[model samples]
Target: MIVAFSVTPLGVGEEVGEYVADAVRVVRASGLANRTDAMFTTLEGEWDEVMDVVKRAVEAVEARSPRVSFILKADIRPGVTDGITSKVETVERHLAEG
Candidate 1:
């Protein structure tokens, strides 16, 4: 199974694009593919791991800019899109297959 999320950030000034880019990189680094509009699809070992990754992703940004004034969130859920879910699921299958 896989958990996916929609990541949204607000009030980003100056380097808004850069900030967004960094966040995207973080998710991709986690082997998650971001769909569109801040949504990411990734695999987790379990439910807890999925949430933990989401938490870390949020913290990564918060830790960077305290004065962020930038509001952010990740909307995580399972089984939203058939393909996305399958895509994330592939990660788990591959891990086991390896």
Candidate 2:
């Protein structure tokens, strides 16, 4: 499964990069396949493990801010691995071929 999530700390004013970084740090340390774009951090792993990472990431953000807003989108497909890169690569291939 691949979970793409965003944790935004509310009531922390406009600048929340530090809190966001804390969440990303937790994801990076989890030893899972992951990627961070401008909007969301995508985590790839078993369902339980991925959810645990997401929970820890939310906790990281919560430590700094009074409230947090969490958003997540997941792709859950059994018998799939490396979907993170392979999915994108597949799109890129089609684009290149066109």
Which candidate number has the best lDDT?
2
lDDT of 2 by residue, 52-77 (tens): 99999999999989999999999999
Instruction: Judge candidate 1 against the unseen true structure and give its global Cα lDDT, from 0 to 1.
Output: 0.53
Candidate 1 weakest ten by summed lDDT: 66-75
lDDT of 1 by residue, 1-98 (tens): 35455444455556555555655566667654344354443444345655666666666666655443333333445555444556559999999998
Best by TM-score: 2
Backbone atom clashes (below 3 Å) for every candidate: 0, 0
TM-score of 1: 0.46
Score each candidate by Cα lDDT. Answer: 0.53, 0.97
What shift in Å separates residue 53 of candidate 1 from its native position after superposition? 1.6
